[model samples]
Target: MSAPNSLKDVYLDEMKDLWSANDQMTRAVKQLGEKVSDPKLKQMLEHSVGGIEKHTGVLKQLIEAAGGQAEPEHCKGMEGLVTEALKHGIKEASSDGKLQDVAIIAQYQRMSHYGLAGFGSAAAYAKVLGMSDAETKLKQAVSEIYKGDEYASKLAEAVEQAAA
Candidate 1:
């Protein structure tokens, strides 16, 4: 078997990937805020945009603490995924308030799931790297995003189901 990378290298690489994804989402959320007609969805997007910016700052601090560069390598994967989501939302556009809200919630939750997974992994890496404060902060971030996704889904489901 090929030799595995050193633990520090592995952790740093994961942070880089997460940083790239965050960079992509940071811009994507703003564009997304404009795409959805629902006021609530727009607010959620705005809130998430702020949270992502905060997460990016924490990531930068963590990377620098690890002796790695704080700069991000752009994540084309998240960019394409978000772009496609926007396109799909547009193509399937509707005036029905409930349907539009459902679409926005689904897309937002999907993105949140991505963030939760990435952040959770990063937290584990930070813990392994002996970064106690970074681990705690990342853990909190992952939990908060997961809760937001659940709350949004519940609100959207209530609207969709009521309309149905």
Candidate 2:
């Protein structure tokens, strides 16, 4: 659906969508942490989860500041990603610690890329809707996520080569 007619409506809708994405990250990261056998992989997933929580709080505050509600809308998109992550983490994960590390890294990198795209779009929409502050926040988050994706790719590749 399109954004709301008013600024407040736009803020609330964006807030709900962002919150939903963050919540999904929380759940998915937990599952990633649990299923992956490597300690390093688990630590990375845990760290990402913390970041997601921080982003969620920021979105919530922005929504409230804009006179909009700050609750999630049960983001089906992220839900699907999380579900797939769990399934892959379970079935595709290797008994070899290094292989599992590579797999987990791949999963998280993909998710980070998705986050970058999502937040980038949201931030652009927020800017167009005249929520410059929210746009800045989201765009910054997107930049971080893009960096994270690059980092994860390198990490995963290193682990994969080591495992080879």
Candidate 3:
């Protein structure tokens, strides 16, 4: 994508970037799901895949509404985050089930925090653009991401206790 010449351009770019980010995260979460042993964690990851797909659809719609192509721009930031997540959560994971679950939670939260920032920024841009519908959808995605992050934290605590 070209350099943003206006706030509208920036908004469109952000949506495109998030579209890519959600796609990457969806794949990573699925891969991680296969590696996890905990039933709750597995379920959370499965749900996340669906949520990410839903957010991606909203992003595509927002991009089109902003008069931009619905194609996703490659999100290098998310690429790096996904790389790190896989490396730490799966590649170097502990053999112990509880410890591995903790590592997975840490990686998952890192990616989720990244999503929160991106979605929140896009929502702000949408608000400034007077695109109330886009803003609402983005805000909803952010809220869902927050809920997942919170659940991951709780799961991490439980896994840690089990490890102890």
* TM-score top scorer: 3
| Per-residue lDDT of candidate 2, residues 27-64 (tens digit) | 87787788766566667777878888888888888777
Q: Which candidate wins on lDDT?
A: 3
Error of 2 at 144 (Å): 1.8
Q: What lDDT is reached at residue 68 by model 1?
A: 83
Tell me which of candidates 1 and 3 scores higher on lDDT: 3
Per-prediction RMSD in angstroms? 2.8, 2.4, 0.8
lDDT of 2 at 21: 74
TM-score of candidate 2 relative to the true fold: 0.85
How much is the lDDT of residue 81 in candidate 1?
Answer: 65
Whole-model alpha-carbon lDDT for candidate 1 = 0.75
lDDT of model 1, residue 17: 70
Q: Residue by residue across 68-158, what tens digits does model 1's lDDT show?
A: 8777766566777677667655557567766766776777677777778878887888888788987998898898888788778877877
Whole-model Cα lDDT per candidate?
A: 0.75, 0.74, 0.91
Off by over 4 Å in 1: 1-4
| TM-score versus the correct structure, for each prediction | 0.86, 0.85, 0.98
Q: Estimate candidate 3's RMSD in Å.
A: 0.8
